[model samples]
Target: MAAPETRWLAVNGAKCRVRTKGTGRPIGFLAGLDGALTWTPFLERLAGERQVIVASLPGFAGSNGHDRLDQHLDWLLATEELLRGAGLAGADLIGSSVGGALAADVAAVWPGLVRKLALIAPFGLYDEGEPTFDVFAVRPGTLQNHVCANPENFAQATAQPAGEDAMEWQVTQLRTNEAAARLLWPLGDTRLALRLPRLTTETLLVWGADDRVVPPSYAGRFQKLIKGKTTIATIAGAGHLAELDAPDAVAAAILEFLG
Candidate 1:
């Protein structure tokens, strides 16, 4: 496979890093709390059939200009600019976790921007009876247990690089988490339910059956709230980051839905 082309774009006055690979109709992807600084196998698989364009959220994954967003409105506006600036308008879209919430928001506020939407364990709804797990409370070494079906995946992804790159990599990880906290702090819910009724795009809700960070049952709540044609897919043995645990399964589900 060839390397993805990288570019920096200005969106809502902030600088964002964007990447594109493959060819054909476009598929815009927004990654979870841990942004996609580089193309992963799961993304590469998606690129096999269509053009995959991934963008790092402002202030995350080495992107700049996050400071420009001071509130939810700022985020929403920035997201709109990001989509338009990155040429993702009117494209098939996919998002996971934090990115999922943003994608849904964009679809809701700007119904015609995304033709189809797929969300992977998106975090935006909260149920008091079945509380979402506190990802921040987990101990450093054991945090993966709650997010990954197999902890080794996190271990490998976070493995400190050798030599001069090690410190930079570690700092990026910490800052990424900090940036996520800005949006998901206290509780992950950002009242997305209130906006769901406005969503008109065809949607797919994909969840990891073994997810602990955001329980798989939340799929029902999301489905009920969305006004559009919505479907659900469960990947057995996967956790919060289903694509990381079962890339082929996630990719298959998304590809089928896109078709």
Candidate 2:
């Protein structure tokens, strides 16, 4: 695959970094709380078949701050505007973690904008029994353990050279976390339960069997909420970041569903 082309899009005065790769059907990918810099092997595989457009959420990466846009609804509106600016309206959508919640919200509110929706370990609804981990409370090392099934892979992926580059990486992580906290601080739920019933687009939900951050049980909750056609797939031996832990499996499932 070739290197992704990067572009800055202005959505409601917020500059968002959008990365594009491959060609053909467009697939807009929304990253998780951690940010969108890391492109998992799953995404690379998907790129082979579709035009993948991944953007850093507001207040992360090169995107400008979103203090003016309050609430999750504003974020969804901004996302819709961003996609429209990129000429990706009616594109296939893929979201991870918080990104998943945003994608679902957009689809529910503007069903015509999304042709298909796929969510991987999405954070939207809250279940009292299967509560999500307090990501903000955990240290970086502990967070890694909660995020990845293979700690070694997490370490390797996050390792940075000791110098200004490493410092910059740390700063980026902090900023990304801060931005994510705005929406997911107290709890990750955005009351998507009530809105999901409005979704009419075909949806795919994938979860890791061993996801500690967001338990696999929430998959059932999503299945029940979506009134449209929905499919669920579980990738074994994977944790919260199933795309990173079981990229091949996750990619295959997504590809099959999108096909």
Each candidate's TM vs. the true structure?
0.95, 0.93
Cα lDDT tens digits, model 2, 155-213, are: 55455534537777887777777877777778888899989999999999999999999
Task: Give the per-residue lDDT digits (tens) of candidate 1, residues 223-259.
Answer: 9999999999999999998888888999999999999
- Which residue ranges in model 1 land beyond 4 Å of their true spot? 158-164
> In terms of TM-score, how similar is model 1 to the real structure?
0.95
Provide the overall lDDT of each model, using Cα atoms, as 2-decimal numbers: 0.86, 0.82
Clashing pairs in 2: none
